[model samples]
Target: MAITKIVELVGESKDNWRDAAANAVKEANKTIDEITGVEILNLTADVKDGEIIEYKANVQVAFPVREQRK
Candidate 1:
């Protein structure tokens, strides 16, 4: 049997929503192993002076559960 875990994360970037989403996975990868997939939940942006200053993405990251060690 196999089990997977899902974690929610919000990533921010100065480029675009796609980058923001990718950033989430990249950041997660730094601490997580065996990442299987990602699902983008929401996309938002911060505007300043009539221009987008930052992009934000809400995402769900999935990974397989690892066995525990004592």
Candidate 2:
């Protein structure tokens, strides 16, 4: 049997939403494995001095569930 798991992660980038999403996946991959896909849930931006400084992205990462063995 195969199981799946989903997790929400937030990533920010000075570039764009795409980079932010990619950053999320890359960061998650540092600790997770078998990453199937990433879904962008929401997008926002931070402004400083009347200019956009950073882009924020909310992402959902899905991967295969890993079971522990005894």
Report the lDDT tens digits of candidate 1 across residue range 1-70. 6889999999999989999999999999999999999999999999999999999999999999877737
Tell me the deviation in Å of residue 59 in model 1.
0.6
Q: Assess candidate 1 and give its lDDT.
A: 0.95
Q: How many backbone clashes does candidate 1 have?
A: 0
RMSD of 2: 1.3
True-vs-predicted CA distance for residue 19, candidate 1, Å: 0.7
How close to the true structure is residue 51 of candidate 1, measured as C-alpha lDDT? 99
Worst 10 residues of 2 by lDDT: 61-70
RMSD of each: 1.4, 1.3
